[model samples]
Target chain A: MYLVADINVEICAAKSCKLCTQYCPEANTILYSDEMGKDQGFKYGSAYVAVDRCKGCAQCVWVCDNMAKNNAIKMIMIDQLPKAALTDNITYGEKSTTAVLASPVVG
Target chain B: MSLDYVKFSNGFEKFMPKEYRDMVEHGPFGKKVSVSQVGSFKEVLEEHPMCAGCAMTLFIRLAMVAFPNPEDTITVGTAGCGRLAISQAAIPFVYGNYGDQNGVASGLSRGLRLRFGDKPKDVVVMAGDGGTADIGFQQVLHSWFRKERFTTIMLDNEVYGNTGGQESGMTNRGAVLKMAPLGKKFEKMDMVQMAKVAGCAYVATVVPNNPRRVESVIKKAVLIAREVGSTYIQAYTSCNIEYAIPTDKVMEDAKAVENDRYQFTEYVSEEAKQYLTERYGYKEFLAKPAAAIPNKA
Candidate 1:
């Protein structure tokens, strides 16, 4: 199981608070992408969980629920998510258009 | 060791947990990070199982960010709501028995000093109001009196939040709770005054309303504790559940409390003032306005 942003991206508060992205243990697991926001009809970008990189620590969920007071994230079984969302080459907003970067494995 | 263990072996890096690897590379272990740079970096604290909108957890998170030398820092925590988030931090934590945090930290800081011998190894005791002002009052006072080289932080929620809501010494007078059926008879214990009287070199009281100020206070306290005598910081981290504060209104309630009772106050001894001025070149660290509370609304 891994964590996912299951709530409406409009109320994510990723651009302002970004507590989940700040506290997540894994790097690149949660990223704020402007392109992702545009796709979701949000003016400012919203945070999304890269399922392949997420360790299911639920740090994002906790921060969203408690710190940001926005219930925008949740944990779900890996099989419950579609296979398309579970990609090793998870691209970020504008940066992904140039290069497809794989999740960082080491420091 | 000398922060060498934070790195993983060349071939074995892939096998390591992403959290551990990320901490080694991007975590604020040996770097200088302020509260403003919070979201851009990986924090030492991770996901916690504490209550939603827990002010104590938020305080703990900000405190973790303020450690001057997180790689060499060791925190001691007692059994309370504070520990639920403290023990989850990336830094090594010593979870002592009920109200034994000060006692444990006294020995731990001494041991670290002997072993490191001038190398900075900060020992911080973070506990709830019941643990500091009530259950471990003796140890806390004695440790300060003995001038142990460490920092003691009281997460004062004004009530015993962990083992059901009970009236603690820090609880304000006329506040009705479980044990105090007819409202508390006495005023809240003035631990801030007691800490000053007990020979703490640096003492301060703050609320977690402003993250930057909280960061500055904690960093200054930890730095002072390293060179000066004992230091103390009391943070008013209200309990949302016990106090019946709405999850969304936690920060608002804290702001209200800060304005009414827990105004930001700092008491730096002459020795500490001189040390800070000379060492860090901070000439006006103590000249904060009486009402420094920012109107962030």
Candidate 2:
């Protein structure tokens, strides 16, 4: 059984800082996107974790909290995550799932 | 005539480095490729249930990249932390008895050779230190003694991770584990030297921090096995949860140990080294002191 870990990109200071990737022992487990905040002036990349591959090691959470000082990544119970985030047909090598939480975005 | 260029879809791109992105586009990352690229080939092992940040997971991924042919390769697994990848791995995998990993691989090697003499498939074993060094030591030794043509990759996490982090033969002295509450009394088992004494044609020890180096060594080990004989690649991984080491500092500790205690060594028989140099122009093989990873704790 795997736990669900999501990344909050809205408040995330996505600047291509690959602390999670650097710290993640699994390859391609945490992917980054630079296009999200390009218009907002910062060039840091938005990070997303591969839920299927995530073993709930929480290294991403550790890096985000301790190293980056941004509590952008949260580890949630698999059942608590939205039904849409969990998919049976996880096409390997495709980063299809976006780990947005169920809580309403506060704008 | 002017051509109309359509915009790509929203989900087409993920967070990937430019170098990796370019390679994935051609055929490796899921596209149809006539040939598989070591760096970008679709991972056969997917969603293993091992602990997140488990070093074995990373080692499997790196080894996959170094694999000569994922399509034709047959992966053999034994009991331990390495078993996590068996079900999810893309290639055809066989789960052997804990103490019979080498025996299974040896039989598979011979069976493949009998069926297709010149085109025998590659057989690779993913085993933990406990399975490789302690329980299955005799079978592994006999396989190397007889020169079985298979690659055995040992993911040495120092302790028996699956069985609640008990001290294994590979556990170093002075480290306190559940089995060794008062700290281990014996020094770590030298599997590298054991492989050499057992007549392994190719051998190397590496860590997960250096992906490129891991890829290079695994690729070399696989090549040597196919052309020469049996090869053993032992990778020093860490059991973060079991070892009481923080998850974030796992790689740091692995690097520190490699730099401070054990110097990473690569061994190749004289004949194989000559063959590699002559055929592949491979001259960059050396054993040197590695820089230590900073210890935060």
Best by TM-score: 1
Question: Candidate 1 lDDT, tens digit per residue, B1-297?
Answer: 357656677898889765566567777867787765654456677666777567787788888888888888999999898887888877889999887889999999999888989998999999999999999999999999999999999999999888889999999999987656799899999999999999999899999867778888998899889889999999999987788886556666888899999999999988888888888887775666688779899
lDDT of 2 by residue, B144-234 (tens): 9999989998989999889887899889888898767898889998888889998998899888766667877877777778768899999
lDDT (CA) per prediction: 0.76, 0.69
As for candidate 1, its clashing pairs are A66-B53
Clash numbers, per candidate: 1, 9
**Cα TM-score of candidate 1:** 0.77
| TM, every model | 0.77, 0.72
The residue-level lDDT of candidate 1 at B154 comes to 96
Displacement of the residue B21 alpha carbon in candidate 1, Å: 2.0
Question: Model 2: DockQ against the native?
Answer: 0.23
TM-score, chain B, model 2, is 0.81
Q: List ranges where model 2 is wrong by over 4 Å.
A: A1-23, A26-28, A32-47, A51-53, A60-107, B1-41, B278-297
Residue pairs with colliding backbones in model 2 are A14-A44, A14-A45, A15-A44, A15-A45, A16-A44, A16-A45, A32-B15, B44-B90, B45-B89
